[model samples]
Target: MQGEDDLRGLAKIMGFMRAVSIILVIMHLYWFCYGFFAQRQWTLELINKILQNFNKTAGLFSHSLYSKLFAVLLLGLSCLGTKGVKNEKISWKKILIISSIGTVLFFFNSFLLKFPASGATSFYILSTGAGYILLMQAGVWISRLLTTNLMTDVFNNENESFQQETRLLYNEYSVNLPTKFYYHGNWHKGWINVVNPFRATIVLGTPGSGKSYAVVNNYIRQHIEKGFSMYIYDFKFDDLSTIAYNHLLKHSHSYRVKPKFYVINFDDPRRSHRCNPLNPEFMTDISDAYEAAYTIMLNLNRSWIQKQGDFFVESPIILLAAII
Candidate 1:
């Protein structure tokens, strides 16, 4: 209630300021055009004397620079009472443009440095009058823009968030992802299509973000169902490996050549099938031995990858290749 009263009082004060400014502007215009409004009967001696006193004041003349300046200042002050809103956004650039042009026109007493002839003040009045009205409106708009509640005014309809594509595309080798999204107050079904599964697609996410359960497992199951031969490198021995083993077992009939499931446990030799790395059955050329030796040494010491031509490095590699 106190705040409301304060606002009401401020509005009343602003109204008084506006009234005083307009009255002064009119008085100034009338005094400057005293000859134009001649031949009028004097109603009272005191009223005539009072108006005559103003005629002597230099600033009351329309041609005086201070006359327009005083009016502009008061109008600007009165604009402080302009009301602001929460949901609407005002364009400051437009307000500035209007106010600047109005200021220039309001101060214009002549056109192109040429003053009108005697008794031809009507055109000057019309131009400045239009300019005064524009200034009045622009001033109020600027005040309202400055006082607006920016937080809520800017977010009335959350337009900054980008629009996501919701169209679902499909192809012969595409992996489809089913989803649901929100729009216009209700949830709707959506799909993300990976059109070419043969092209490498990396699944990336933070821990517990469903990298395995939602995406990896789905891809494994679908690929198995499509009769794809997979070589899975599982970090968690049982997590993905177990899923692939069980899925392939169920979908084994889908493959033209029934694929066997083999488990290689490097930590437990008893659980792993014994195999020789230097087995001659798999080597087609001498380069195959060198490749095996290169991979072994690099895995043992990764820095050796940059030291390929070093004698100590090449010697061991050559020895390993001969043994293989």
Candidate 2:
């Protein structure tokens, strides 16, 4: 039985190694293509043209596309490498850290030497080469890490068992608390009580519905003041800015308040201003909440599809009808 278990573990490791190898190969291919065929001069000109046409507004579409493409590529490589190792011990945290570091270094080097018009000088050439070497080493390290049984905590420890494992039967479709919420204390005169954490609810209404005020003023003031980190993805700078500014002044703690307002004017590149969130010159306003929500959903769905291949699989007619 012990021998069989060892064999299974080895097989899982081998599977992960194979997947990492494929991912590395793909990365190499991308680099080669960019270096040889997609000439930097042309690419820069193209980007300039795109910027000229779309200006700051291009971020709405372009950023999402770029993010999704990278995400899918990573997910595909992961799936290919660990198709049959679903039950195997995996250190996701370590994997994330290593992968993020590798990606950052890759871009850093590429931007520094490769993208700039002037090529690397004799003094910096060796350093640039060393950076590339480190990137390749990072990739190899990730591959080895994935294959090795380094994460003993995953299976060998009872105390470290996840909540799902503690339960007898595992069901993925369990109701859980929404990650975020908008609460209004001032509107109802403290009538709003703390709702059960497990329930997912959305308070929807028109402009005067107190949604923005609740989210920015009341909820942020109550929860965020108590050391909770919160993010408000406000597209059009409005009430969020007001609340943030007020919080900064009122709180004795040095609260850093920054508002980023983008002036996406196609006419003038110089006028295309983006304020720093920490030292924001403008207010926080979000125009299209629906578009923002849709973007979030789209990304979420893509991630879901990557994790569970059959997540969106349905009858042909049903799928087609839904798409229509």
Candidate 3:
């Protein structure tokens, strides 16, 4: 797992380097052209002339043609690089970091060293590096500004009730909530209420599509690290349950207040524990009796409730409620 993570990280870094290199290479080539020929004022006149003199005055090799071609190449590269980054898997954070590093390095090379610009390779290198860094930083800032503007518009367009609810939730939870959320190829914070603040979350996918691994690696991992008690129902091979048990054991050993771990596999009736969900001890009072019944009913009739509506499942729920 560690090796896999390392490889993933390396791949992301390599992608970042590829993106940075594209920008750098284009910038360097543009700088080389400018230094070699754009300095000549005759190049501008030749472009404006539209070859009226025909092949009389050095034709395309003249400074005018060379500079114009270079300019077009520079513009083309800029567009290509921008489009490439948009389609690539590179992250903004990596781009920003690399740009910042390049900017710093070029700043030192240009100002501290006081390098002479006599068409030396080092001079072009420093100049182009600085230019690329500045351009990329501007691009990053513009993208961020646009993203912020879009977010603001979305917030403004949202319903007042939704806004209020969001604010209320934010105010209600001041501390960071741990969650095992995956979004845009990144693992993000998922809200798992440790204090029985139940919120329904469902993960669905075809078999062998990493549904179990995602749950165990992300959600279960967070639960263990945060010391949250869990009632895991592992029906297939119990791989996730085993991983959770190992983590729980380690956590229990580390903490002063040892947490409990249980495996209530009903398949192996002899090995199964004697904890009953229907046990009255699990309920607080008559009010909780309905909830306990509803929980057990939902667990037992998952397929029925899923195929039929909750209204269809209401009868059994009410019956179990009264019986409990």
Candidate 4:
């Protein structure tokens, strides 16, 4: 309410200011062309005397062109409070472009009017002045045209809205994540497709966010169905292994070569497939023995992988390699 009242008050003041500006412009025009009028005896002596008195008293403002410029300046300032309307065509750039043309024409003709023998001086002055006035009014009209957008929060977030992918892409290794999302009005089905399983995939979610049940299990089942030979490091050994084993068992015919499932569980010896790292058949040199030692030690204590160059870590690994 207060803002609206303020705008109304400003508009009224601006209207008054514009009226004063127009009156000043008219006065300047009359004063400057007074000699032209007097030559034809169009103005009375009494009125001429009053104008002369005004010219003398105005001091620094005596110059007709300067006074007119000041009035034009005031008119521009008054345009600030003009109520604006919504207009699509007339932009600020266009307003400036046409106004600039008018400004040049008005000043050029104004300068030409000063020459005593200048031809068409009256016509030029009238034409340029009218053109300037029309351009200035166009600017005010633009102000009115722009006011319809005075809304506080009329933002369009629609530009950021986009079409979600509903079609699933397929390949030999692409793992599809079933996705359900609401966009616009309807629920759309999509896939968070991972094309290359070799690339590191980081799955992040809060506990109970279905990281295991929804996404992981689907990946295991899909890969098995596609006949991929995958080695899964199940943190919960049985949880993922069971899913992979069952899914693979159901889709065994898909693989061209028969694939075997293996489990290495230290917690329960009966549940694990026991194997010798330094089997005589595979070990041909000391390097094989060293590698077997490195793998065994790293698997026993994973931290040893990063501590390979350390003296204590290297000493134990070398000792194990010698024994093997």
Better of 3 and 4 by TM-score: 4
Ranking by TM-score: 1, 4, 3, 2
Report the backbone clash tally of model 2. Answer: 12
List lDDT for all candidates, in order: 0.74, 0.42, 0.52, 0.74
Cα lDDT tens digits, model 1, 235-317, are 88878989999999899999999998877779877877677777889898999999999889889988988898999999998
- Candidate 4: misplaced stretches above 4 Å? 1-162, 282-285, 295-313
**Against the true structure, what is each candidate's TM-score?**
0.52, 0.22, 0.34, 0.48
The alpha-carbon lDDT assigned to residue 262 of candidate 3 equals 71
Tens-digit lDDT track of model 2 for 74-182: 4344443332222343355655665566555444443343344434322233443343344444444555455545455344333222222112221232222222222
Which pairs, if any, clash in model 1? none
Q: What is the per-residue lDDT of model 4 for residues 201-278, given as tens digits with 9 covering 90 to 100?
A: 888999889899988898889989998888888988799999998988899999999899888888899999977766
Candidate number achieving the greatest TM-score relative to the actual structure: 1
Angstrom error of the Cα, residue 196, model 1: value is 1.5
Cα lDDT of candidate 4 equals 0.74
Where does candidate 3 stray beyond 4 Å?
Answer: 1-206, 209-215, 218-226, 294-320
Off by over 4 Å in 2: 1-190, 195-201, 214-216, 252-324
- Deviation (Å) of 27 in candidate 4: 27
Residue range 1-59, candidate 3, lDDT tens digits = 35446746765664565464554354334433444445553245544354435324635
